[model samples]
Target: MYKILIVEDDNTIAEEVGRYLMKWGYEVEAVTDFGDVLGHFGRFLPQLVLMDIGLPFYNGYYWCGEIRKVSQVPVIFVSSASDNMNIVMAVNMGGDDFITKPFDLEVMAAKVQAILRRTYSFSAPTSLMEYKGMILNLSDMTLVCRDEKIELSKNEYRILQTLFENTGKTVTREAIMKRLWDEECFVDDNTLTVNINRLRKKLEGLGVEELIVTKKGIGYRLGEL
Candidate 1:
């Protein structure tokens, strides 16, 4: 089933959309934190997004811009401000389609189905992930900061990729090496440390201080500043 991430703030409408989408067999997750929209977007990794313009902290346009910075996932704007200006702004901010508030559920579903098919039919979806403000592009094997870029070696990319995917939680070193060990021969502790240090320096260049935190004797984690 296709995943649908709902960035609607209103509980009634968000849950309503969730219910409707669930009935149609699309997995759904509603946004609970207004201040950290991109965080949820990274964690959810939804195939499609339904966002409302007027929100609690930053508006939908702000969140839309943030999502656009990382992935090309289809985002359909759903808002009461369906004026010509808002519609045009949504498009300018990278929204795929617009649906005014108090919409027919069936029509919304139809638009969603059409957009997903059109967007993902001919090409495989990009698998790069983002957290906070960093983007790890799996297609090109590069990590991009606001303006700078970091090229990753195979081991460095896998290690960073695994940690990013499990950000907001502790990822054991063993887990990281198990993933690395799958692709390469017996990796020594020094080898893993070298890879992690290289990845950290690349991230440091991006202005992220201590991007990957060592959790004592446990594992590694990405923390928001």
Candidate 2:
């Protein structure tokens, strides 16, 4: 299911929109605390965000810029400020679309659907996967932790992608090899060992030790931090 975040302050509007979106089978979260919008965002990691222009603590544009610094998740502005300047600013602030206040909920829902299709239907790489405070940016093939961007080679990316996809499960060596085969890479037992060692060292450098635990002749599993 695609998760959505709503950053509007008005109680009635937030609850109403949340109910409408929930009825459509979308997992929705409406922001209540205005002080830590970004913190909420990182935890929810919503695929899309519905923002309001006139928020309590900071405006939608400010929060949008903050989100852009870390993620490219699509943001659609739903606001009462329908002026041209505000609309242009919304787009300039990394908003995907804009909807003025007192708008039809059906049209809003349709816009949400259209934006989701355009962003995800083509399998766009602008998405993030987070595990144990480690965020993998598929778009850039980089792992971000504590503001550090660790670049991953093609082989490293493939291995980590496999592990992240399975999360808590133990991924067999043969399974990882199959993923590498799909990339047309020649990976043998020794080659997989070397790549695993390198990736582990990189993770350790970021103070994330024991993230990948070997299963003793079985395979590897993603362990707790």
Candidate 3:
């Protein structure tokens, strides 16, 4: 299912939209903290965003601009401001579409579906995985934290990719090796250990300590930052 983030401060509208979208088989999350919209965006990694202009801390346009910095994910501005100026500003700030508030839920959902289909039909959905505050950019094989980018080698990327894919579960060493093997790159025990150590050091440089925990007689699991 496609994930969507709703950045409206009004609890009622957010809940209503979230519930309506969920009924349509979409995974949705609403932002409660206005001060850290980008943080939420990084963590949720939504395929699309529904934003309201008149937020508490910073306006939706500002948040949209910030999101554009790290991601090209589609953003749809949802606001009561139907004025021409607001709409134009929304577009200039990287909004994919605009939905004026007091909107019919059906129309809102239709707009979401249309945008999602159009945005992802010809291209792959944005491949991003987030744990704690760290984001793994799967397409470019880089890890991002606090606005900094860290490049990863092929083996390093694959290792983190496997661990990120199984965040809440332990990924066995054999399973990780199999993933590498599937790519036709054989990884023995010592090589896998070296890769894991390197990955841990990289994570450490980002102030992430013990982000990867080794389970004795088992495999590795991602720990909280």
Task: Write candidate 1's Cα lDDT for 1-225 as tens digits.
Answer: 899999988899999989999999999999898987787776778899999999998899988988776678999999988789999999999999999889999999999999999999998777868777577878767776664567888888888789877879999888998988865577777777888888888777778887889998988898776
**Candidate 2: where are CA atoms >4 Å away?**
1-3, 9-11, 23-27, 31-47, 53-73, 79-89, 100-107, 110-128, 137-140, 182-188, 204-207
Q: How close is candidate 1 to the true structure, as a TM-score?
A: 0.76
Give the Å error, residue 199, model 1: 2.5
Better of 2 and 3 by lDDT: 3
**Model 1 lowest lDDT segment of ten:** 140-149
Computed on alpha carbons, the lDDT of every model, listed in order, comes to 0.86, 0.87, 0.87
- Candidate 2 on 10-46: residue-level lDDT in tens? 9899999999999999999999988778767767889
**Least accurate stretch of 10 residues (summed lDDT) in model 2?**
124-133
The C-alpha local distance difference test score for the whole of candidate 3 amounts to 0.87
Deviation of model 1 at 9, angstroms: 2.0
Evaluated at residue 103, the lDDT of candidate 3 is 91
Each candidate's clash count:
0, 0, 0
